[model samples]
Target chain A: MSRSVKKDTLLKVAESLFYEHGFRGVGLKQIINEANVATMTLYNHFSSKENLIEEVLKQREERYWSYLDAHVEMESDSPFILAAEAHGRFLKEESYKGCMFLRAIEDYGEMDNNIEKIARGHKQKLLEYFQQLAHRKGKNNEKDLANQFTLLLEGTTSMTPLIGAEKATEYSIAMARTLVQHTS
Target chain B: MSRSVKKDTLLKVAESLFYEHGFRGVGLKQIINEANVATMTLYNHFSSKENLIEEVLKQREERYWSYLDAHVEMESDSPFILAAEAHGRFLKEESYKGCMFLRAIEDYGEMDNNIEKIARGHKQKLLEYFQQLAHRKGKNNEKDLANQFTLLLEGTTSMTPLIGAEKATEYSIAMARTLVQHTS
Candidate 1:
C-alpha cells in the first residue's frame, strides 16, 4: 500500500478493533496484523501505540462533532437536541459499542495523562458545543442552560446500553427539551 | 491472619487499588502483595481473580447504596438529590476516582457476562431506588420520574471529573429537583 493508504488502513482497522474490544484489549501486533501492514510501516506512521490511540481518538472526536454539526444545521434545532438525536442513531447502528472516549478514559485515564487529556478535551469541546447552541437560542443564562443540556446528553450516552437506544434517546430528548425551554 | 480478616483485608485493599487503577490494571499477585496475605490464603478466600473482582464490586456497591439510603432518610430529600451530595463529598475525598461500576462495565462488559451483570444490576437497582423515592413522593408517573432522576445521577457521576465535582453535582441536583417537582 502507498504510505497514505497504509496510514488510513491502520487507523480504520485500529478504530474498529478498538471500539469492539476497547483500547486496552487490542495490542499493536493485533492492530498490525488486522491492518495487514508491516510492523515497521505501523511504527513509521505512528511512533507508538499511545500515539496511535490518541490519533484514533482525535479522528473519532472530529467525526462525532462533524456529525452533530451536520444534524444541527439540517434539523434547524438546538445542538443539544440534534446531538442527542445523532447519538441515538449512532447507538442503534449494528457496529455500535459504547462511547469510545469514555471507554478510553475508563481504561487508561489514571495511568496516562495524555489519554485522560484527550477524553477530558472531547467532553469540554462537547460542553462548548452546547454553550454555543444555548447562545443561539438567545438565552441569558447560557452557561447554566449549556450545563443542563450537556448533563442530559451525557446521561443519554451512558444510559443507552442499559435502556434500549430508542427509549433512552426519546426520554433524554424530552428531558433536554424541558431543560432548554423551561417547560415541564 | 484469620480467614475472615484476610478476606476483609483483601477486599479493602483490592477495592482501593481497583478504584485508583481500574479492574484490569491490577493483578492477583499485586493485590495479594498489597494486602500482605499469603498467596494460598488469597486463593483460599477467592478461587480466582475474577471472583475477587466480583467481591470487590459487590462490597463497593453495598457501601454506595447504603450511603445514599442514609443520606436520603436523614435529609428527607429525593435520592437523586442526596446521592449527588454524597457523590460530591466522595469526589472531594483524597482517594476519589471515577465510578467503579461504570469503569468495570467499560473494561470488561463485552467479554465477561458476570462482570457486566454486576455492573448492570447496580444500575438497575439504582433505578429501582429512584422509583421507590418517586413513589413515596406520590408521583403517578413513577417510572419516568425515576428514569429522569437516574439519568441525571449517572451523568453527574460521569461528568464530575470533566467539570469539577462540585459544579457537576450542583447542576445535576438542580436538574433532578426540576424533574421531581415539574417546576421549571
Candidate 2:
C-alpha cells in the first residue's frame, strides 16, 4: 500500500478505537495491531502517539464539518432547525459515544496543552459557524441565540448516551423550535 | 486514624483525584498515597477499586442533592429558574471538570457494568427530580418540560469547560427562564 493509504488506514482504526474506548483507554500497540500495520509504519506516519491523536481529531473535525455543511446545503428549514436536525442526524448515524472533541478534552485536557487547544479550537469553530448561521437568519441578539442553540446541540450530544439519540434529538429539536419561535 | 475516619479519608481523596484526573487517569496507588492510608486499608474497606469508585459516586450524589435541596428550601423563584440557578451554582463552585457521574460513565461505562449503572441511575434520578418539580409547579406536559430542563443543565455542564462556568451558567439560566415563560 502507498504511505498515504497506510496512514489513512491507521487513522481510521485509531479513531474508531478511541471513540469506543476513550483515548486513554486504548494504546499505541492496540491501534497498530488493529490497523494491521507494523510498529515502524505507525511511527513513520505519526511520529508519536500524541501526534497520532492530534491527527485523528483533526480528521474527525473535518468530517464533522463536511457532514454539517452537506446538510446545510440541502435543507430548507430555518437555520436553527436545520442545524439541530443536522447535528441530530450526525449523532444518530455517526457514533453515539458523545462528542469526540469534548471527549478528547476530557481525556487529555490536564496533561496535554496541544490536544486541549485543538479540541477547544474545534468547538470554537463550531460556535462561529452557529453565529454565522444566526447572522444569515437576521436574528436579533444573534450571539445569544447562537450560544443557546449551541447549548441545545451540546445538550443533545451529552444526553445521547443516557437517553437514546432519538429521544435526545427529539427533545433538543423541540426546544430549539420553541426558542426560535419565542425569540422571534 | 479510626477505621471509619480512614474510610472517609479514602473516599474523599479518591473522589478528588478521580474528579481532577478522571477515573482511568489515576490509579489506586496514587489514591492511597494521596489519602495517606495504607494499601491494605483501601482494599479492606472497598474490596476493590471499582467498589471504591462506586462509594465515591454515591457520596457525591448525596452531597449534590443536599446542595440542591438547600437552594430549593431557601429560594422563591419559579421551579425551572430556581433549579437552573441551583445547578449553575454547583457547576461554578464544584469542580468544573464536567458532571462527575457522566464522567464516570464516560470513563468506565464500557468496562464496568456497576459503574455504568450507578452513573446512569444518578442521571435518571436527576431527570425525575426535574419532573417532580415541574409537576409541583402545576405545569402541563411536565415530562417534556423536565427533559428540556435536564438538557439545558447538562448543556451548561458540558459547555462549562469551553465557555467558563460563569458564562455557561448565565446562558443556561437565561435560556431556562425563556423556556419556562414560553411554556407557561
The candidate that achieves the highest TM-score relative to the unseen native structure: 2
Question: How well is each residue in B1-184 modelled by candidate 2, as lDDT tens digits?
Answer: 4459989999999998888777888899999899999999998898788889899999998988876887774225486777788888888888576778877787677775798889899999998988888887778887888888898988998898888889888988888877888776
DockQ for the candidates, in order: 0.53, 0.71
Error of model 1, residue A167, in angstroms: 1.8
DockQ of 1: 0.53
Return the TM-score for each candidate structure.
0.87, 0.92
TM-score of chain A of 2: 0.92
Give the CA lDDT, 0 to 100, for residue B19 in model 1: 80
Between which residue pairs do clashes occur in model 1? none
Clashes of each: 0, 0
lDDT per residue as tens, model 1, A37-134: 99999999897888998999898887776667666763365666777888777666522445788767766766756877898799887777777777
Q: How many backbone clashes does candidate 2 have?
A: 0
Model 2 CA lDDT for position A116 = 85
